[model samples]
Target: MTARALRRRAPEPTGSGRGWKEQTRRVSELCLLGIVATVLCLPVLTVGAVVATLSTVVAHWIDHDDLPPLRDMGAEFVRRLAPGAVASAAGGLATLVVVRQVQWLASGAVPGGSPVLVALLAAAAVLLTVVLLAVPRLAGGGTWRTAVTGGWHALLGRPAAGGAALGVTLVAGLLAVLLPGTVLLLPALLVLALHAVHRALVPGAP
Candidate 1:
């Protein structure tokens, strides 16, 4: 074999190495974002704003291939705070009510146990899916009312996409339950999943 022939036979470097490196960097960034979001959510009421901020950050990253500055994220959180708090409170109350009902039903206090329990579970799942689908819309710059309405419509418009979002939420929740430490990353993971699901399911989604 001649030297020239041997050189030509050498395999060209593929982009797989670069792809893996990019994926790793993206994952690291998401982990950091998740930790920051978890800290911001410690106040409880701020959970909604933190989620909106995370969603905005994820959207920016998806569109720009870079994370926005912390200052920008902070500003976004402050802007969303009031409405976010209200929404968070309402959501919390609703969740509590559902949980109580579930507990009551599970304890056999209710007459129609299995059917009622199944209905409640289905409703909860649907609500969770709608909220998951709507988080990405929070980045669209609108009143909370509009964002929520749009999210609901989005779900109606794309039932399959809503199902996919629900699956992602369920998987994320299961992972968080199985690995308590992942709870810290849950917000970021969810925001990223929301973006991925929307972008894949909705054409021209930035």
Candidate 2:
């Protein structure tokens, strides 16, 4: 065969290929990561660490355009466990307080009634948004203290990005509540959404 004919017959390099197959592969990887992270979080206390590790993995994927080995996630989870526990405890306490307050307000035990309840709900939403934005910082190898602080600053610095991330999370929560089955994929989707929002908004973020 002629050189031109051989060249035309040669398959395109795998690395350079793009289309639905590549998109499907990426989605499948995220689903696997989500399932694995959810399983790791079954202990409850490890939820924070699992999220942080997943965030790191997703960030790595975003930077490199490929997922890392699954085994590496386990090592990252262990390394993050201590600080993640602290974050989890703090987050849990805060959630408990908010829930209690919401319950009390909803029962009409408070003076302002609906207005007060609305304000409280808004505050809780803002707090959750800040925490969502901070998950990526946890993977930056910082202490829980630093991650929380950085997350607050990041939200303040980029309110639009924070709002976008919060919207993504709320949508995910709604889907989980409505579909139930989607809970299996929620973890990875949340991490990916947060990272994508940050990468798209913040200048030079990976």
Candidate 3:
């Protein structure tokens, strides 16, 4: 063979190249899932189920390094419907109570508007962090009790990471409140942030 021919290298296998392609595909899948999740979440009662499914998809991707079929997610969603809806309803009710309390205080019906607002915001941050952890636990095959208690453990064990996740949620919430249109982006951002937090905080989490 000529020197030039000898110098040429054979094409490499596509396995590694496929990784980036795989990641890109996963990202697109996440976005699409987020879109579906956003629509499902509109009813509000399905919020917990949607969040759980989002976390399940994320965990599945992390653990298996593959995209689960949409049908699998759909099946899981169906299975989780009852519990998820119940949880969502409870959470919504609690949130409504908080909102009403906050409004009452702000309207001068009570003595401590500023203090109440600050306290409520802090409470919300903590609650949001717990819920984020809980959903992923459920997605990972944990029961409701495990989801709740494990969430607290995860949050306490990794305060910094938990705080960061809560912070992202808060900022996104504020932006949604202010711009309204930015609410459209909240689902994708929340899922991505919570997935990152789960990877960091959940032992054996994928």
Candidate 4:
């Protein structure tokens, strides 16, 4: 059997356990990273943002072929902003606090490391975890626990694919930092959007 195929068959525990929560947390962390990258790489990420924005429409279109063309998925995003804003603010603050605590604890070992930067990165990680876990729960589709477990299985079972995904995320993040004025952010957004589309379009991506 191919290595990829073997990874696909890893014996991942399904939604029936606490393992799911961890999975959800990581997913949230990943999403948080995307958001940070988008904001940081604003000017250059326009195309990517547009692509990601479009992916939502495409996902719906694929699910319901008879759906109206050009359905304003964009509009719904705007509408949700009010609610998302509250949630995001709360989430961000909590993340920042916890990350700071963690960094302070780590300071004893990492002599000269910047606690602020570490804390910020840690908060981003926590934010990703929280978002992934919380969003799915709020959507009423899956518990944060279920999404985490299922999502991790999706990664663990496909090591190569999972690694590639991390690679894409890292490169996109780098573009956000290195070429803040470039179009890479849009591409990054598209990559994310394409991922969403692919999963939705596929029969059983997860």
Indicate which candidate wins on TM-score.
Answer: 2
lDDT of 4 by residue, 99-150 (tens): 6666765665435456655766765654453333222222222333454465
How would you encode candidate 1's per-residue C-alpha lDDT over 41-66 as one tens digit per residue?
A: 88889888888888888888877777
For model 2, residues 151-178, the per-residue Cα lDDT tens digits are 7777888899888988898899999999
Task: Please give the TM-score that candidate 4 achieves against the real structure.
Answer: 0.42
Error of 1 at 192 (Å): 0.9
Pick the winner on lDDT between candidates 1 and 2: 1
Model 3: weakest 10-residue lDDT segment is 9-18
Which is the winner by lDDT between candidate 2 and candidate 4? Answer: 2
Positional deviation of residue 64's Cα in model 2 after best superposition, in angstroms: 2.0
In order, how many clashes per candidate?
0, 0, 0, 15
Prediction 2 global C-alpha lDDT: 0.81
Model 3, range 172-195, lDDT digits (tens) per residue? 789889998756556765767777
**Candidate 1 stretches greater than 4 Å from native:** 1-19
Give the alpha-carbon lDDT of every model: 0.84, 0.81, 0.75, 0.46
Candidate topping lDDT: 1
Candidate 2, which ten residues in sequence have the lowest lDDT sum?
Answer: 138-147
Report the Cα lDDT for residue 173, model 3: 86
Higher-TM-score candidate of 1 and 2: 2
How do the predictions measure up, each by TM-score? 0.86, 0.88, 0.79, 0.42
